[model samples]
Target chain A: MPVIEVTNLHKRYGDVVAVDDVSFTVEAGEIFGILGPNGAGKTTTVECVAGLRSPDRGRVSVLGLDPRRDATQLRERVGVQLQESQLPDQLRVGEALELYASFYRDPADPGELIDKLGLGEKRKTPYKKLSGGQKQRLSIALALVGNPEIAILDELTTGLDPQARRDTWALIEQVRDSGVTIVLVTHFMEEAERLCDRLAVIDRGRVVALDSPAGLVSSVAPEQRIRFRPSAPVDDRLFTDLPEVTSVQRTGGQVVVTGTGDVLHAVTSVLARNQIIAADLRLEQSTLDDAFVELTGHRPAE
Target chain B: MHAFGQILKIETRLYLRDFAAPLLTVALPLALLAVFGLIPATREPDPQFGGRSFLEYFAPSLLVITLAMSAVNILPTVLATYRERGVLRRLATTPASPAALLAAQLVIALGTILVSAVLLIAVGRLAFGVPLPRHPLGFALALVLGTAALLALGLLVAAVARTTKAAQGMAVPVFMVAMFFGGVYVPRFLLPDFLVRIGDYTPPGVQALLDAWTADAPQPLHLAIMAVIAVLAGAAAAKLFRWE
Candidate 1:
């Protein structure tokens, strides 16, 4: 059975519908990503799953128990790192972890999580004294300290630098590898494409598309654009007449061919036949960003 | 209960690190006592005080200041800061409820209040030669009721204020009202007859506490008013408090 199943969940706040008709299931041991830009109801949907908010119009089941009715039990099994939530300014990193650890029946050692999240040197540092990246890492450590079955991390890398972001991504993968299911909420297309095994793209309180990153990319765009600089002059029709080629154009010194299905091979063959070497050859396909724009009809904020 | 203990332990540690609470709870009241106690005239019994020394008569104001500062100013700011900073929101996500965190904070505040109370009484006895409350039982009862009433007022401020600055701003009127009626602003003797009557209705029941401090018993009217205010304000605070 799926570890989490959300069906037709709807919630509104004083006539403002924060979440409406959001539905998805997270399988055990997989990293499920909820990808959307800010104000897309991504956090609200996960907050419902985490038992922080009650849904107005549908059923949500986690571990075969209702999220609201079994909220206490659910909290024990579902560790949540909320978006824009924080600890006391004077609380030390190790003390914060240990305090959270004591709340659960079974818990991961604070020392282990500190080391795992690279917060060892900062164990004695007060929360307010830590850098943004260090604070983010400590919050992640607090979430995992409870030895929960599922961990929901929202906007987990919003404040980290490039290297720290990469390091955090690696740490999340390691957490997933250790037999825990993960629900990651993020807006960055690259992070979603890299970390998520499957994702549900939320936009304006609805799911635009739900599939693997590659699947979403392929479903929206099946063609590839191959760009190369030819060693010798060539006619555009030489490539355009092929079955796989849709259009051929030359920009300055470079020839660009757009086609679907084995178009790269077909273009290379045409180049060889003309005794022209394709210099600086490159092929690019539609990424998640393109898929997002195609599905939502607007570019996602970077 | 176990989770509450752990959270309480951590909150205490954080309280020490910040130390604002301890300073206000222990040092501020003692400093007030020292400044006033140094006056030779304050130690002399005067006709204005009905044959009571200033140090003896002004003793209840020390308690009033300590309680009002904790319940109205210090505690509200701390709680409001927690809400503003999302500490309560994060706690709500864990197995331990946010109620546990609030309870822990209250417990820490109560600990400081208790320590301050003990020290105040000890210093009054040893240094200034003021006797303990004439009716110890009445004094203890007033202390409990006064604390509950003042803390209820503080919680209401904590519930309503959105930021620490707002909490401080909001607390001013409340703390001032408490101080005014508690006779910190104007001593009960100097106040008009009608105003002294109004003090009986206000929370912290400072007149009742003073009566219990030097007389046989606190007024029953003051205890009843404190109980009613505690329940009503506490209910309102519970209704209005926001986790985030």
Candidate 2:
């Protein structure tokens, strides 16, 4: 059974509909991602699941418990790292971790958790004194201190540097390895593609597509590109004539062929038959970034 | 109960770490008392104060100042800042509810005010030789009711203010007005009859009730007004406060 199931969720603030008929199920111990641009209802959907907000219409169940009615119970089982939530400026890192840990019946050791998050050196440092990345890590540490069955992290690495983002991704993988289901909300395609087991791409308050990262990329743009430096000058038309090939282009010493369905085999067969050897041949697959643009009609905003 | 205790513990620690707030809430009132007590005229029994010395008559108002300054100027700003910074929103996702944080804030504020009151009373009796409240039960009742009324008003301000800066802006004018009415600059006994009557109706009006209790003449009317303000303002604050 899925750990979290959100069906036909609808939420509105005043006249503005924040989420509309959104539905997805997160399997046990899997990293489920909600991918979207800013204001695309990713946060709203998770807020409902976290029991932070009640849906106007729809049903949400986490661990077989209704999120709204069983919020108190759900909170004990689910950890949450809100997008922009902050701690008091004067609060120390160890103090914050200890305080949050005290809320749970069975909590992870805050000292070990902080050390794992690379915040051991900053234990006594006040919140206001920490760097942005440190603060983000502390937020994640607090979320994990409860030893929750599931963790919901919104905009997990939005402001981190590339190195810190990679570190966080590794930490998330470690968290999942420990048997905790994760629901990650992010607009970064690379983050979703690398970390998420499956993704629900949302746009304008609706799920446009739900699939694994490779599945999404292939579903949107099935055609693959094959590039190589031809041993001898070759006619680009020779590649396009093949049934599997769609278009062919020649740039400098490289021959580029774009096609679907066994294009690599068909192109190589043609090159072999033509008495020409293809050197440094490489096939490039479409990325989630490409799929996101195709599905949403715009690039994910930063 | 466990979560509430944790929140209270952390909140108290953070509150104490904040030098400016404690300085204003605790030390400022004592400083003012000491400054006024040094004047020989303030130590003499005065006909204007019904034969009580100025130091003794002003002692209750000084205590009220500590409570009012904290509730009006400090409490609202801190709570509003928490909301603005999403601390309350963060707590809403935990088993420890945001209401725990609000309750913790109230407890901490009242706790600090109680400490300040004790210190002020000790200093008044020791350094200034002002008499303690003769009707201790009435004095305690008036102090509790007065704190509730003023803190309720502060919560109302916190509910309406969108940001910490806005809270501070809203709190300052209210603080000045409350201090003026509570006889911070001018003693209530020395105020014109019309001003005194108006002052009697304000949240700080409890100062008059405290004074009456200190003099062993407890006034039911003053206590009733304070209780009414406390209930109404408390209800309104609860209704209006938002987690985010």
Candidate 3:
């Protein structure tokens, strides 16, 4: 059985439909990404599933329990890390962990979970004293203390530095490896690409695309791009004559070549025959970001 | 039962960390108690009330003040801060119930109020030679009614205040009215007849009813009415409380 199944969820605030007919399933032990820009209903959908909000329309089942009707049971099985949620300023790391753990019937040992999150040395530190990245790690640790079957993380690495972001990604992977189903809400295409098995790209309260990162990118734009700065200006038509090269465009000293199969080999041979030692040469594949912009016609903001 | 205990512990820890507020909670009232209970009573007893010292007349009132401070002044701040900081929202996702949180707050407040009451009573006895209550049952009845009334009033304040700042702002004016008119600052009998009449209609009006309940000569009818008002206010608070 699916660990979480959300069907036709709808929520509106005033005239704004925060979540409009969002439907998805998260399989057990898989990392499911809810990819969307801000105000795209990612957080609302997750909050409804986590029993924080009661949706006006739709059915949500987490571990076969209704999020609203079986709120207590659902909270016990699901762990949630909200985007702007906070602990009290005076609450210490260890105290916060223990207090939350006490709310569960069978909680993970607070000391062990703290150690796992590398917060052992910061146990006595008040929440106000921690850095942003440290606070994020502590929030994740609190979410896991219930020994939950599913974990929902919203904007998991939004404020972290690059190195901290990578460390968080590793921790997420470790959590997934332990057989915990993860529902990651993220706007970062790279995060979705690196971490998710499947993703749903939502826009304006509607899902625009749903597939694996590779599948979505391929489905949107399947061709590969090759670019090189030639020693001398070359005619665009000359590159297009190659068997693998589908199209070519030249502007200034650079040539952009689009190709079908074996494009790299064909382009490199063409370059060699012309005695053109490419100044800046690269082959590129379509990324999730490209698919997102193509689908929504807007670059996602942080 | 275990969950209840855990909630109580968490609430207590949070309260302990707010060192300044609680010290004021305990100290301010005790200072008032010492001033009113000892300073005026040094000379002699009031012959009209059967040779009772002023300290004896006011020690029970200090207990009511302690209860008022805990429920009316302190409880609103605690609830308002939790709501403002999104603590209630966070707890909503946990196994803790709304009812459980309120219950924990009541238990913690009652416990602290009781300790403060004991200290004030001891100080009154040692410093001013105030007599112990002649009727323990009557004093207990008045104490219970006063506590219920203040808890109700505090919860009511929490329901109306949207933010912690608003709650703190509301607490001051409301507390002054409840204290001055409720007969904690000065006994109602000493006020002008019109003001006394108004005080009787307010929470401190109910205090006179409690005072009547625990008076040297007990008054059962007054105690029953005061106790009924306490229950109604508590029910209203519960009905109106918003966990958001």
Computed on C-alphas against the true complex, the DockQ of each candidate is: 0.84, 0.85, 0.60
What lDDT tens digits, residue by residue, belong to model 2 across residues B149-230?
8999999999988899999999988888788888887888878888878877787574555565457755777878888999
- Residue-level lDDT tens digits of model 1 in A87-157: 78888888888899999889999998899889899989989899888888888888898888999999999
Mind giving the per-residue lDDT tens digits that candidate 3 earns over B1-244? 6667877887788777878656766777678776765466442688744466655655555555666678888888888877776677777777876567778888888888778767776776677676555566766666666677777888888888998898888887877776776667777557787886665545534444334433554456545655676788778777887877
* Model 3 docking grade: medium
Candidate 3 lDDT over A27-93, as tens digits, reads: 9999999998888999999999998889999899989898889887888899888887777788899
Between prediction 1 and prediction 3, the one with superior lDDT is 1
Indicate the residue-level lDDT of A136 in model 3. Answer: 92
Q: What is candidate 3's CA lDDT for residue A145? A: 91
Candidate 1's DockQ is: 0.84
Model 2 stretches with alpha carbons more than 4 Å out: A251-254, A277-282, B186-191, B206-210
User: Lowest-lDDT window of 10 residues in candidate 1 chain A?
Assistant: A293-302
Interface RMSD of each: 0.9, 0.7, 1.5
Which candidate wins on TM-score? 1
Docking class of 2: high
Comparing candidate 2 with candidate 3, which one achieves the higher DockQ? 2
Which scores better on lDDT, 1 or 2?
Answer: 2
Clashing pairs in 3: B182-B204, B200-B205
Global lDDT scores for all candidate models = 0.88, 0.89, 0.80
